[model samples]
Target: MIDFTKRQKEIMTILSKHEPITAEQIAEMLGVSKGTLRSDLAVLVMTGQIEAKPKVGYYLSKNMQKQKQQDIWNQTFVKDIQGVAITVKGTTTVNDAVISLFLEDVGTLIVVNEHNELEGIVSRKDLLKVTLGNAQATSMPVQLVMTKQPKIYTIEAEKTVFEAAQMMVYYEVDSLPVVKPVENSQALKVIGRITKTNIVKALIEMGSEA
Candidate 1:
């Protein structure tokens, strides 16, 4: 099943009880302005959670809802939504890493060793925590604040996106490093990354096809 945000879930509940509800009604009941929910409504429609008619408003998509569950089960593999991975070296300084983070526009950066082997992960939170009390954050190595190996959560390419989504929800992470086992070696090589946005896009694409 597709993961629904708290507000989305509430909206769905409202629709279930009142079919063909107006967007203005949903927004009013949810205590948010109608304008702010445009994307949410679009996503709901695009993901096949709801059907919309310009004059008729929105209602739960009965037919697509049934197919959605099965689609989630059948579309197995993280590779389906994987995107090119972005990485930083363990030696990268906080200043440089911050610049890279903005330049790349990514939430997390995979840290690698000299051999391009996975070392750890540095997230925006990690950078913020270290920078809060330290004036020398610019010179400090990312390795100093990065979440180290054994603590990082990773997914193999073969794993289902459902499994990856579950991991994200459970771990409260925005993204996951996609890795693959190196033959005859104990190390895993980072190949790609999957984010919540990727999952949403995949769902919308599938819904469109459906």
Candidate 2:
């Protein structure tokens, strides 16, 4: 089962009762800063639990509300959304990894060891700092520059898509590594990835049907 923090639950309750409300209103009611409210709102939005309107404010979308209810009732993980993950070896050169990111049109890549265990993650932003400084990508190894042992987030293959969506939102990341249970120490293998683009595509498809 997916777990939410007390603060997140409180935020959800507030939005449910008085949605289409501004971040300011939420902050004032919760006795918190606008920044904190915004962060909480971002998590809800990313999880598809709530939506923000430009001038109108924030509201719990109909789909999300229904989904939440369904989750509480049946508590099933819907596997409708899916995507493939691209990975690179930790020993790969920075230049090669950069090329892979471009070719895949993805913002992140999971770095693995020879045993197919997740070693680290490299993101476009991580490479950007070095790339902009005129450093030779060829000379730099991905291991030297990549984010080591990043907080790896994952969802069960059978879990609801929203679970993965929520994790991405909570962590403020673009993608999540899909994994399967493995042995000790390296207990998960990178199997796939989920991104904001994938979530948007699913939403668009749902909208098109309506």
Candidate 3:
């Protein structure tokens, strides 16, 4: 069953008792503005917990359990679903990076320095653009072809997978490096990586388990 928020439960209860109540009335009883309940009402309607009548008010749906749905990944932690990141030193040759990318079956590689701190990320597209016609460039360091620090997108281990997915879509990235802040420093330490594939696989796994 889908878990309802506290306010949503109260709204459901209000609807049950009132049978059909307007949004303004519900907001007044809850001591909040109707705008505050707008999203909550939308969710309830979409999830089939409640229904709205034109020129009328909202009513609790009769078949609540039939419409029940769970957002399994909404509150899931990135750390729980992330995969081990394939990493290379920034100084690693492009040729070796390519080999690692293929061997690991991953599209991107995390590039770090001796400290194992995140330096940059190199993707197959970046490598392809550089090594397409120029064979000699294969010996070049990955740092040259990598999208450097401050530009690389990363997520915290504690962040929800939903937030990670949002970042991926907004940034137009296939994956994100999961990171943890270093002690007393602004530097980020690579933890793992969350990819579109990882998210999909997790959804499948969670669904199967359920």
Candidate 4:
């Protein structure tokens, strides 16, 4: 789960044999500088793997079971990686999409219909290809340039972040629209997004929690 470094694992091993250990003792045993230990210890403490008592010492938390840590790492819910999804209506002009792209500072825009149901996706490259030199390109509807349904890739909130990442790599895209499938309808409602950057943010948060 929290892919600990070899030195960090050794630090844990040392703590396992001793109920509580001093920071100095850990650094000496691991042959690492206090500065290095500080970072490792911070991650350990942040992840709840170890507890530090001021003026006392560091001790492994009783609740830090291996299985518990594994369970936390196994979480795949897309909501765990959810972030704001920038969108534009299919009827919006390419010019407007460009403006939104610049205004929002996002690489792609989710295109939706009147009901806010997913219709397609537009990327910077998509806009560039059609609008780069054409004077009338700006007036064209975004839907005309978007990668529409049956071609665009999407992820569900219930899916795992790993799967989301996999889809991005497979599709050679930087992001995926997070959607909710209607029980009886053919449409999906766009809710959020999970991007490569979102994955990095999630990992950072996980490290912080760790």
Candidate 5:
């Protein structure tokens, strides 16, 4: 399914009951300005879920098959929309970590070894807790405050987006490191990072294709 947003579904329902309704009337019923819904209407029209005419107004499209639009949200892999991971070495100082945080504009940084294997994860909040009251801690290694291996949560590169989303909700995390198994060793390589923002972007992109 296209995973229609609540507003989009409501608009469809209104069209089903009152075919050929104008955008203004739909916006008025929903208590929002027509401009606010322009994008939503455009998406519906582009996806073939709804149709519009110059003099007539809007109506539900009967040609579209809801099921065949299928379940991209559930079947897509983490690698499909994953972004490059912002990385830092475990030996990196807390001061430098802060600099990387701002420079990278990422909430989490994957800690890696010289071989580029996953070692730990340090977040913006972790940096704050370590440097909040004690200025001396800025000189300390980030490993001291990072969530190290065996404790850090990660998602496999091939895992489904559905699984990634479920893990994020259950763990209450904003992002996860995307890892791939290393040959002849148990260590995992940090290939990418997946965040809530990435998931949202994926949904929006896929929704448009529907």
Candidate 6:
């Protein structure tokens, strides 16, 4: 099951009690910047925990009630977070990574070595900086262009989805790599990736239609 952070829980509680509220109101109540509140709101909305109305503010979606009944959050696990996981060899060129990103329609790519062990992670932002002025993408190795030893987040297959959600909220990350324990950090194996998009989809599937 996914986990919810204290802040996320508090925010959800606030929305539960006073939804259809403005981002300004949330910011004031939470003593956070509007930008931070907006980020939280984006995650919430993406997870189907809240809904936004143009010029009307945000509200707790009707799905909340159904979520309670089905225990939707409790049913989520690492396996539920599966998606297309494209891997690139560390020796691959930066240009190849860019092409993969476009072709795969993915923002991030997991870089692996010859042994299929994760070496690093590359995101659009990482590539943009180098591509901004450079003409050669093929010359740059992915290892030199990727975010090495990134802060890794994981959840066990048997854990509750709420726990996973909480971790994401606490870390302010869009996704978490579900992994199986290995002898060392370099040995970890990615089983799946839990993302905000998947969480929202799960909520919609379990929540009320309206």
TM-scores, each model vs. reference: 0.67, 0.60, 0.68, 0.67, 0.68, 0.61
At residue 91, candidate 1 shows an lDDT of 91
Worst 10 residues of 1 by lDDT: 64-73
- In model 3, state the lDDT of residue 6: 100
lDDT of 5 by residue, 155-191 (tens): 9978988899999999999999999989999899989
Q: lDDT per residue, candidate 1, 1-210, as tens digits?
A: 778789998888788667678999999999999998888898898887899988998988987466555667457579988998889999999999999999999999999877677889998888988998888887999999999988999999888888998999999999999998878987779989999899888878766554
> Cα deviation of 68 in candidate 4 (Å)?
9.0
Q: List per-prediction Cα lDDT, in the order shown.
A: 0.87, 0.75, 0.88, 0.86, 0.89, 0.74
Candidate 3 least-lDDT 10 residues: 64-73
lDDT of 2 by residue, 142-205 (tens): 8877777646666666766677777778988887777777866656777777777877787676
Off by over 4 Å in 1: 1-64
What's the lDDT of the predicted structure labeled candidate 3? 0.88
The pairs that clash in candidate 4 are 46-210, 47-210, 76-160
Winner on TM-score (3 vs 4): 3
Could you tell me the TM-score of candidate 1?
0.67
The C-alpha stretches of model 2 lying farther than 4 A from their native spots are 1-79, 207-210
Residue range 1-210, candidate 4, lDDT tens digits: 789999888888787666478999898888878888998899999998899998889987877545434445468578987898898898899999999999999999999888789999999999999987798999999999999997879999888877887788888988999999877998999999888998877767765555
Q: Cα miss at 110, model 2 (Å)?
A: 1.1
The TM-score of candidate 3 is 0.68
Summarize candidate 6's per-residue lDDT along 1-210 as a digit string, tens digits: 556667677787787667678888888999988888767778788888888898988887788755654465776665765564577988888888889999987778888667666667788888888888788765798888887754555566666678877888998877766666667554766656667887888777655432
**Model 5 TM:** 0.68
List, in order, the clash count of every candidate structure. 0, 2, 0, 3, 1, 16
